[model samples]
Target: MAVALITGSAGLIGSEAVDSLVARGFDVVGIDNDMRRRFFGDDASTSWQKSELERRHGRRYVHEAIDIRDADALMTLFDRYGDSIRVIIHTAAQPSHDWAAREPFTDFSVNATGTLNMLEACRTHCPDAVFVFTSTNKVYGDTPNRLPLIEQDTRWEIDPGHPFAEGIDESMSIDQSTHSLFGASKVAADVLVQEYGRYFGMRTGVFRGGCLTGPHHSGTMLHGFLAYLMKCTVTGTPYRVFGYKGKQVRDNIHSADLVSAFHAFIDAPHAGEVYNMGGSRFSHCSMLEAIALCQEIAGRPLSWSYEEQNRVGDHIWYVSDIGKFRRHYPAWVQQYDLTALLRDIHDQNVERWHAGATR
Candidate 1:
């Protein structure tokens, strides 16, 4: 059986990719040291998800609790697997802009240096493997915030006449913008992934993702916006809405939908390709809209408050233009819209809470 290696394998995207690849008959190896707990405390631990994957997949899934920053350990695993590793899905990251500021060194070490380790291992051990990096839309930095936006009663919308009314595409500049420390680290990794494909002629695809969300997310204040919002609504926890009058908009794609795109790229591998992956115009919500939806789904009013200051480098409006991805892979399409996606998150959060499984 071909081996499929995944970093951040307990994460929302990583776990989804593991299940998808295993269903396709590949032996899966997952690398996750549960760094999330270190980043966001016990509430954000992914240990439960890691255990669940091991239980479900049995011997087919090999769980390696090694930090990607440990070059020796990663190299050892790569050498052990050798050329049998057919795919590498890199979803591990220091995902929060706020948290990245507090510990810039740790963020850079994990997001940038760790990615280098993975790239080198792939180059040496499995040069033929399809390498998929789950890059963030933040790589564009605050560039999208400069767009002309019109605020309505509930949300912010890009000006209709603006070129980006449809959504921001890849042509937007990644330079001369206020990228928080987290964005900078991701930028370093993002460019390196592209170069690996272009310079080394390796098959690497960088997906600049928007809000990637699903039930599996261990939501926290600093990350997992949709999941955290739903969790707050379900548990009667107070939710804080920062900046843009709670009108800031985000396009959210379900984890399953994003994983489907990865599968599409794997089937027809490309070298040094970049795609803006998100819900696009088909599925998006503002903070206000999201709260209302969560409240409706949970059958309880969410206790939310607004703050004047927004998170540094946070986008006021960001909806990805997925036209390029769709044109390239006609078979790929979104399976969940905004309402359905929120409902799923709400139901899952409630179930987990009631089961006392909030790990």
Candidate 2:
């Protein structure tokens, strides 16, 4: 049996992977201990999603509550599946910059060390398995913030004539900038994946994702940008916008689109291939633009306030250049733009958001 192993398997991307890969007929082993709850509180818990995957896929989907930080447990699990593990999608990490400062050690151990554990396990038992890592745009730290930006009515945009107006690509350096602790840790993990692929001939692809989002995200104030915004819109919860006149821009990718990209890489494997994966110019929005869209979609004005200070290392404008991925997987296409993305989020979870708000 072809087995696929996924870390953070209940998360927005991971859960999407579970559903997609199962439909492709791969028996999937999912590793997640619900650390997101520990990092972002109960509202961000993915336990509900975990139970749903098991229910829907049954014997085809195996859920392991093993912490990726626990190497011994990982070795045991990897050994059990052995070489049948044809692919490993590592997405589990402490995902919030604000929360990372509260416990740097916890963040490093989970993000950096946990990744190492997965890499080593794959090398030991299934060295040839296609390893797909969900890295972040934060790996560029505040470098993107230094781009030549022009402020428009609703968004901070890169100067139209600038070379990167198309969008920031893989050429952007990941050095010499403040990366928040979360970014630093992710950089370490991202580099490690590259090294493993180069040195050991492992088939690994590092995907530096922009705002990865979709209806599956258990979005919280500390992370999951788009999800949290729509939740606030639907639930009448007050939202806060930080700095950049609330016009800072981000490109958002639906989880399904990202997972499809992962499958593309797995089929035609590469070693240490790094790609900037996000909606790119196809689907991007500013804080103000997103708020307006959410309000329009949800048909309710969000109660929101702005603070002068933005989150440390937050980008003023960032849209990924997915040209490389497209050149490689030309058939892969993005299905949702900003308005479609927000509308899907609202349609899927309006009921859940309303119920949670009452609590």
Candidate 3:
């Protein structure tokens, strides 16, 4: 059986990628240090990801709890599994944009240095493996916002003359950015992955993602926007909308869609290519709009509050232009629209939390 190794396999994006890989009949190996638990306290949990994957797919997902920064351990895993491993979906990173400054060195180590470790391990142990990296739209920085925005009922957007209102294409400028420390670190990883592909003839690709959400997300207010909204709505937790008068727009794509893109890249390895992966033009929503949609899906009113100040380096508008990937994997078009996505996530949050309350 062909094996695929996934770093951060217990994370929201990583876990979903694993499930998708297993369903597609790949022997999957996952590695994580459960740093989320350390980072977010008890609220950070990944056990459900493992248990649920087992129950649903009947695949005993092999996992190793090791920090990827430990080069020896990462190389050892690759050495052991190199024979069957054909792909590496590099998804592990320090993801909080606002918090990266508080722990800059740690963020740099995980996001940039750890990626270097993984890439080197692949070079030594599985030189032929395809590497698919999960990058962020933040890498484009704040330039997209300067393109001339017009506010609608729920979100801020560019006027028609401005080309990117539909979404941002790969050609968009990444120079003018205020993406905080998190974006800086990720950009380092993104560029390094490309350098490896360019200099060493490795098949590496980057997926610049927008808001990626699914059932397994341990959503916090600062990150995991869709999951946080769904959880807040269902649990009646206060949902705070920050900045732009709750009109900041973002495109939310399910992790399943992202996994499909990852699989496509693996199946057809193209060296150092980058593609934006997320909801297309039609799948975007503003903060207030999303809240209203979640309310409709949950059949209840969410206790909502807002503060005017924005999070540091938070982009006012970011929707990915997936036209490039669409051309490559036309069949991999989004399976869930925004409404269906909201409903599915709402039900999952309700079921999981209610079960927890009962237990």
Point to the candidate with the largest lDDT: 1
Q: lDDT for model 3, on a 0 to 1 scale?
A: 0.83
Q: Rank the candidates by TM-score, best first.
A: 1, 2, 3
lDDT by residue for model 2 over 1-359, one digit each (tens)?
Answer: 99999999999999999999999999999999999989888888999999889999999999999999999999999999999999999999999889899999999999999999999999999998999999999999999988889889998888999989999999999999999999999999999999999999999999999999999999988888799999998888899999999999999999988999998999997799999999899999999989998999999899999999988988999999999999998988888888888888888999877777411
lDDT (tens digit, per residue) of candidate 1 on 1-359: 69999999999999999999999999999999999999999999999999989999999999999999999999999999999999999999999999999999999999999999999999999999999999999999999988888889999999899988888899999999999999999999999999999999999999999999998989998899889988887887898889999999999999999999999999998899999999999999898988888888889898888899999999999999999899999988799999999888877668778666663
TM-score for each of the candidates: 0.99, 0.98, 0.95
For all candidates in order, the CA lDDT equals 0.93, 0.93, 0.83
TM-score of 3: 0.95
Worst 10 residues of 3 by lDDT: 350-359
Count the clashes in each prediction: 0, 0, 0
Task: Rank the candidate models, highest lDDT first.
Answer: 1, 2, 3
* Residue 167 C-alpha lDDT in model 3: 86
Model 2: runs farther than 4 Å from truth? Answer: 357-359
Task: Give residue 156's error in model 1 in angstroms.
Answer: 1.0
Q: Tell me how far the alpha carbon of residue 138 in candidate 2 is from the true structure, in angstroms, after superposition.
A: 0.5
lDDT of 2: 0.93
